[model samples]
Target: MIAVRISIVLLLLATLFGSSLYWLIGQFPGFVVISLGTTALQFTLWTGVLAVLALWLLFRILLSLIRALVLPGLHLSRNWQAKKQHKNSQLTYRGLLDLAEGRWASACKLLTKTAAGSELALINYLGAAGAAAELGNEEEVNQLLALAEKADSRNELAVALTRVRLLVGKGDYEEALPMLELLHGRHPTHPYILSLLERSYRNLQQWDQLEKLLADLRANKVLGDEALRQLEISIRAQQLTALAKNLGPDMASNKQALVDLWGRTAKSLRSVPVLIAHHAALLSQLGEPVQAEKELRRAITKGWDKELLTSYGLLGGELAAQQLKTAETWFKAQPDNPDLLLALARLCQRGELWGKARDYLEAALELDSRSEIYAELAEVMGRLGEHDKSLQFYRQGLLAVTGGETQLMVRA
Candidate 1:
C-alpha cells in the first residue's frame, strides 16, 4: 500500500512538472550556453537536466551488472577457505589425539604437516615437539620447538615450558637447567615454573640449587608435605655422601665437619630414621664408632626403627657389651620382631658368644625363615662345633632363598 501511494505521488509530480515545463517554455524560452574562445555550445535548460539524469541511470545499471557477474566466484572463494580451515582443524585435533595415544611418529607427521595452515598452529607445533622428543629425535625436537617458539611469541611461556619439559623427559637435565633458571627469573611465583626448576635441579643432583628452591617450593606448595620431607632426606643423604667423598685422612677435621652438619640440620629432620641411619653408618666408616654407637643409641631410644637397630649391632668400640645390652633391651619391647632378633644375633656374634647367637637366630627363624637368618645360624652352629647341623642349616639357607617357607620335610 505504501509503494502504490509513493508511485501515485511520483506520477502526479511528473505530470505537474511537464505542465509547468510547457508553461515555462511558452513564457520565457530560457537557454544555457558555454563559450570557449568564440566556439559556443548552447542547450535548453530542461534538456541539460534530462541529460544529467540519464547518465546517473546508466551508472546504476552498470554497477548492478558488475555485482551480478563477480558475486558467485567470491562466494565460492569464501567456501573454499572455510573448507580448508576445517580440514586443517581436523588435522590438528587428530594430531593431538595421536600424541595422547603414544603414536609419536604419526602425531609428529600430521601435526608438522598441517601446522603452518592450522588455526591452532601453536598447539600443533608444541605437540609435534613432544612427539619428536618421545621418538628420541633430538634434532627434530630442537627444530620443532624452535618453530613453536617462533610461530607464536604470545605463548612464550608455553613454548619455553614445553621445551624445558621435553629436555627433562629425555634426561637432559644439564642442558635444561639454564633455560629453567631463566624462566624462573621471569615467572618467579609461577607454580609450574618452580616445579619444573625443582625437577631439573633434582635430576642433575644440583642439591645446593635445589636446597635454595625449597623455600619457594614450600611457599607455592609445589610438593606435598610428605614429598617435601622425602626430598629433605634425599638432600641430607647426598650431603653425607658428598662429605664422605671429600674427606681426607684427618680424623679430627672429619669429626668436626660431621658434627657441624648435624647441628645445622633442622631439628625435625634430625628425627628421620633414614638420615640418622646414614649419619651413623658414615661415622662408623670414618673411624668414629663410639660416636656412631651413641647416635644410633639415642635415635633408637627415641624410636624403634629396624634399620637403626641393625646399624647399632654393627658398631664396634669399647662399648661392644653396651651395644649388646642396648639391643637386648629392645627385645622386651619388640619380642616378636624378626629384625630385632636378627640384630641381637649379630650383636651376640660380634661378642663371640656363638651359643647365644644361635639361640637368637633360632628364635628369629621360628618367626620368619629368611635366607640371612639361616645363613647366620649355620655360621653360629659351625662355630659351636655342630658340623652336621651346620651343613643341614647351610642347605636350608639355599632352599629358603629359593622358596622354603612352605616346604615340608618328613620326620625320619
Candidate 2:
C-alpha cells in the first residue's frame, strides 16, 4: 500500500515537472549541445530530463540483476558453513559422550577429526588423549597431548593432570612422579592432584613422601574421617614396616627411632589393634621384648585383636608367663573365641606346659578346624609321644590347606 501511494505521488510530480520544462523550453527556443571526439549530440531541456530519468531507471535494473545473481550464492555459502559447524558440534558432543561411555576408539577418532576446527580445541585434544591412553596407544597419546599443549598454553594444568592420571593408571609411577610433583608445586591444594600424587608415592614405595602428603590431605580436609583414618593406618604401617626391614648399623638408634615414630603417631591411630600388633612384632624382632610386651598388653586390654593376640603368644623370655596369664584372663571372657584359644595354646607351648597346650589346641580345633591349628596340634601330639595321632593331625592339616577336598591316610 505504501509503495502504491509513493508511485502515484511520483507520477503526479513527473507530469507537473514535464509541463513546466516544456513551457520553459518553448520560451527559450534553444538547445544544449555536447561534442566528444567524433560524436555530437543536442537535446532540448525537456528531452535532457527524459534522458536522465531513463538512465536512472536502467541503473536500478542493473543493480537488481546483480543482486538476483549473487545473493543465492552467498546464501548457499552461509548455509553450507552453518551445516558444517552444526556437524562439528554434534561430533564433539558425541565424542564426549563416547568418552564417558568408554568407547575409546570411536571417541579418539571423532575428537581428533574435529579438534582442528573446534573452538574448544583444548577439550577436544584432551578428550582424544584420554581415549588414546585407554586404548593403550602410547604414541597416539603423546601426539594428542602435544597437540593439546600447542593448542592452548593456558591448558597446562589440565594437560598435566590428564597425563599424570593416565601414567598412574598404567602403573608408570616412575614417569608420573615428576609431572605430579610439578603439578603439586603449582596447585598444592587440588584434591585430584593430591590423590594422584598419593597413589604415585604409594606405588613407588615412597612412604615418607606419602606420609607428608597424607598429613597435608588431613590438614586440608581433603579426605573424610574414615578415609583419613584408613590412610593413616596404611602410611604408618608402611613406614614402620620399612624401618623394620633395615634396622640400621646402630640397633639401639633404630629402635629409638621406631619408638619416636610410634610416639609421634596420632593417639587414635595408636589405638588401632592391627597397627599396635605390627609395631609390637617389629619391637620383638629388634630384641625389645619389654616394649613389645608393653604394646601388646596395652592394645589387647583396650580391644582384643586376633593378630595382636597371636603376636602376644610369640613374645619370649620372662614375659611368656605374664602373657599367658593375660591370655587366660581374656579367654575367661571369650571362651568360644577360636583365635584367643589358639593364642592360649601357643603361649602354653612356649611355657612348656605340654598337657595344657594339648588341651587348649584340642578345644580350639573343636571350635574351628583351621590349618594352622591342625599344624599346632600335630606338633603338640608329637611332643606328647603320640606319634600315630601326630601323623593323623598332620594329614588333617594338609587336607584343610587344600580346601578340605583331599583326604590322606597316614600310618605309623
TM-score of each: 0.81, 0.80
lDDT of 1 by residue, 113-145 (tens): 999998778889999999988899989988988
Q: Write the per-residue lDDT of candidate 2 for residues 1-412, one digit (tens) a residue.
A: 9999999999999999999977887897766788999999988765777788999999999999999999999999999999998999999999999999999999999999999988999999999999999999999999999999999998799988888899999999999999899888988989898888888887898988888887678776778999888988988988888888888889889879887989879988888887887798888888888988987887786667787888788776678788888788888898998888888999888888988998888888778888888899889889989988888899999999888753332222
Which regions of candidate 1 are displaced past 4 Å? 1-11, 18-58, 283-291, 378-412
| Window of ten residues with lowest summed lDDT in model 2 | 403-412
User: Where is model 2 more than 4 Å wrong at Cα?
Assistant: 1-71, 405-412
Per-residue error at 202 for model 1, in Å? 3.3
TM-score of 2: 0.80
- List the global CA lDDT of all models: 0.85, 0.87
Inter-residue clash pairs, candidate 1: none
Alpha-carbon deviation at 176 in model 2, angstroms:
0.9
